[model samples]
Target: MSRAIRRNSLTEQATDALLDYIAERQLGEGDSLPPTGELAATFEVSVPVIREAIAALSGIGLLRRQQGRESVVAAPGATHLSRLLTLRVAHAAVEDDAIQQYREVVEVGSARLAASNRSEESLRELDDALADLRAVADDESLHAADIAFHAALARASGNDLFVLTIDALQPLLHRLRRRVWSGWVNSGGDLTSIVEAHATILERVRERDADGAARAMTDHLAQARLGLDVLSGHVGDSPARD
Candidate 1:
């Protein structure tokens, strides 16, 4: 057994061992895995434990299994994460939860930094984006521009981690934005109201009011969630997604 393997949970040990093996061997997609018996022996665990570990990895699309054959490494993609986000939004609409809490933290922290660090040029860029969002008739275009605006704010934070985190979150955020806007439109909420909410956030940032910008962003997200809930006819109340 590797010295790094945990002595506690067999599942944890199995998971760590498989990940370490993949990393050390530089395994790639479609690569045949070693036999489960070999993995069981290597980890000093039962075949069933190893099987459970493989099943977990397969669930994440990180491994593929064949009858009477070694499992194969799989190409990991964003599909799993996208599904997670869909489930999260479906749950968040009805009950305030940790995901919403964490999202607020990211949004407020990024907005505050943006307010303090944004340059005149960046502000102008945001203005143009807002204008484009207002003019776009297609919901997809509007949602894309909205994401661009928020990502620009993250970049303005002058923090590389913040920028990367926001970038990684772009896909899910774009999906959520579309859902929210579609709901708002169906609920008879004016598009101008949504655009003006974003404008207020930008205005606060431009004025260098960090606290005000953070609050505005929180409000904007809360309203967005409500709008989505109404539009989906409470479909967002469920905590699971297909």
Candidate 2:
């Protein structure tokens, strides 16, 4: 019996104990957890309390529960982070520039890695995303294609962590991309140049030129910064357009 010593709230204590149980047993994705009754008995809590703890864990993607089946450890995902960011943006809890800066760090590094690690399949995905981006006339579809391009680049980096972070950022990036692109259009900016920027990055990555890929990504981000500045009234027309 894995006894849960009460430290704070009973539910919290039970949750902690449950986590300990999982770690102790080295449970992994698809690994079934012991029954609720067994957990309740071990934690010295009522079955309802144990269920509450399980629910809390499940909410965060730590466990998957189903009717008539034992709860299993879940495969990790960005779903919780994605939802949290979407909600934060909804409530204005985070700034767009902050999000953009964080993206600069993650994506620049991803572009660099992708140049060295990309496969034929990832290159094909990037080509498809770029084609969609070039073809889209509407804001919604353009933003979707832009995100697909970035997400595919992140995947090409051959890093699971990068893929997860970019996946978590997709919803937020879609809104930001729409805002930036719309602002640029409203300011008489050429959307063709925007597509060309992505094309340059892909060209460098496809050539396996790591430093060139990083520089292309950096330039792309600089252009986005100009768009953001124009949107925020920090600049009147992007100087890059001059």
lDDT of 2 by residue, 18-57 (tens): 9999999999999999899998998889999999999999
Candidate 1 has which clashing residue pairs, if any? none
Residue 14 accuracy (lDDT) in model 2: 93
Model 2 residue 67 CA deviation (Å) reads 2.0
Clashing pairs in 2: none
The TM-score of predicted model 2 comes to 0.88
Instruction: Write candidate 1's Cα lDDT for 1-242 as tens digits.
Output: 66786466898779878989998999999998889899999989999999999998888788999999999999655565556555766777734333445567898899899999999888988888888878878778888888888878887777776776667666666656766777767767777877888899899999999999998888777766665677657746734321
**Top lDDT model:** 2
Q: Candidate 2: which stretches are off by over 4 Å?
A: 1-7, 89-92, 236-242
Clashes of 1: 0
lDDT of each: 0.78, 0.88
